[model samples]
Target: MKTTNLLMSMVIATTLFFVGCKPKDAAIQAAVQAKEATGITVAVTKGDVTLTGEVADEAAKAKAEEVAKAEKGVKTVINSLTVKPAPLPVVISEDPTLSKNVIDAVKDFPMVKATVKDGVVTLTGEIKKPALITLMQHLNALKPKKIENKLTVK
Candidate 1:
């Protein structure tokens, strides 16, 4: 009876020892998150860390992985972060240049009159429906800030 009791006690002691030695997932996640920048998400499961969310660039993504790996109790890091797409630059023509271009564009449509100010093109007068599309295409190619169509379409 004493031998059986001793064996049972040893098993219980071993289990507690192992459990106490392992770090909790929540604690590891908190440690990693504190060191990372904003916009990064940290998830921990059984000492494995997964990083997700959008970062500004590839360098930022790599840096986040390094941080997670460096944290204590993190067995491995899985980086699933995405890089943000760059925005397209807007092109706006200068007033003097846009004015000259607008005049040339509307010359073919005798019924259309165009005026440019502060990179904005204003169209007035009358135009046949068929020629309106062509006139607009020409003006848009010049990259004006805005186009105000006040033309009476026939």
Candidate 2:
């Protein structure tokens, strides 16, 4: 009878230790799968999900939340995502002279395309002649905060 009692106690202790260790590994697996399936990388701690990485907009953010919540072991989801806005295309205004000047500037560069919207000029396309930082400096001189250059030239 004493031997049976000891075996039972040992089993109970082993079960408790295993139970304590299981959740951590389960949470890690859930986080990895959540990231792989949803494209939203997540970190799971004690079943709490932390959604991270850059997303396009709010919809992507909400979708990530839903994905993490769907995971069986997740207790709560904490969203922390950055939204990157799309660059606007270049469009000249009614004034011919000003539009022509802007066009001349782009033509001189041979790779940059500037798009003006609501007085917010977004320089898209590419630039090859000078370094990207130099081009940005010139554009910044033209307009302080209104310049959004989405050019990729190596």
Candidate 3:
């Protein structure tokens, strides 16, 4: 009877060990699968997996989460993935490199202030002259998205 008790205890201990080990093993495996499934880089530390990288958009971020969750042993997924913003269309209007024509074009317009950032140009201020209509026509020819004309003829 003592031998049987010893055997049963050994069996129980072994089973507990296996059960404990299984989750850790599964966590590791899940991490691997998640890394493979999503091209995003994954770091697993202390049962928490952090995903990092740029994804196409919000939908892609959600898809990445789904992949991580479907894995067998992931306890928690802390997604650090960022959705890349859509690239703004390049403005050919005031490109310094494109043509000197756009440069010389704005030279005479004292009222129009042009500010360019990230390939976007913002035109602000005022203009007044019958000849200024010609100047504005030339400015519009430069191809900014839209001219914000705050000009009042004085």
Candidate 4:
């Protein structure tokens, strides 16, 4: 019984010693992912973390910093993130048929307005949140140079 107790104490002490040691990179990455900071990269060197990536928006960029800093063993957080929205496609061709087809495609959506600029299809107006995916399908079938989704969900 005495030997068993000694072994238990040793095991506990060893665990306590290493318990404070954490993988900084993995900790920061897990924290960022929990906050839905996709596309973010984390590099950790001796508890200093550097975050780099293009987030969806300014809010996402800020959240990334907050999460990285909150991670265990992170002494400092360096944020080198850029906020870049989706690129707008340049006008390739202007076709009346394209507009007509796009409009008909998303006609089920309410107050949906479609315009063709160059070869890109621009959709404006409001749609139900669920319908956005279906609308994309209909629009993609036409194969426009680019799609500008200006539609808002009601």
Candidate 2: deviation at residue 113, Å? Answer: 21
Error of 2 at 93 (Å): 4.5
Residue 103 Cα positional deviation in candidate 4, in Å, after optimal superposition: 27
Expressed as tens digits, the lDDT of each residue in 1-154 for candidate 1 is 9999999999999999999988899999999999999999999999999999999999999999999998879999999999999998998999988888888898888878888888889999999887899888889999999999999999
Candidate 3 Cα outliers beyond 4 Å, as residue runs? 1-8, 19-39, 94-154
Residue-wise C-alpha lDDT for candidate 4, range 114-136, written one tens digit per residue: 88877788888888877889889
Candidate 3 structure quality by residue, lDDT tens digits, 63-122: 887777666667788888998889998656545642355457667877766665444445
TM-score, per-candidate, Cα-based: 0.65, 0.48, 0.49, 0.41
Q: How much lDDT does candidate 2 score?
A: 0.67
Query: Which ranges of candidate 1 are over 4 A from the true structure?
Result: 93-113, 122-142, 146-154
lDDT, candidates in the order shown: 0.93, 0.67, 0.68, 0.79
Candidates, ranked, TM-score: 1, 3, 2, 4
Per-residue alpha-carbon lDDT of candidate 2 for residues 64-141, written as tens digits (9 for 90 to 100): 778777766678888887776787865534434434545655665767787655555677776664566766665554
RMSD of model 4 against the true structure: 12.7
RMSD of each: 4.2, 9.6, 10.5, 12.7
Best by lDDT: 1
Superposed by TM-score, candidate 4 places the C-alpha of residue 149 at a distance from the truth, in angstroms, of: 26
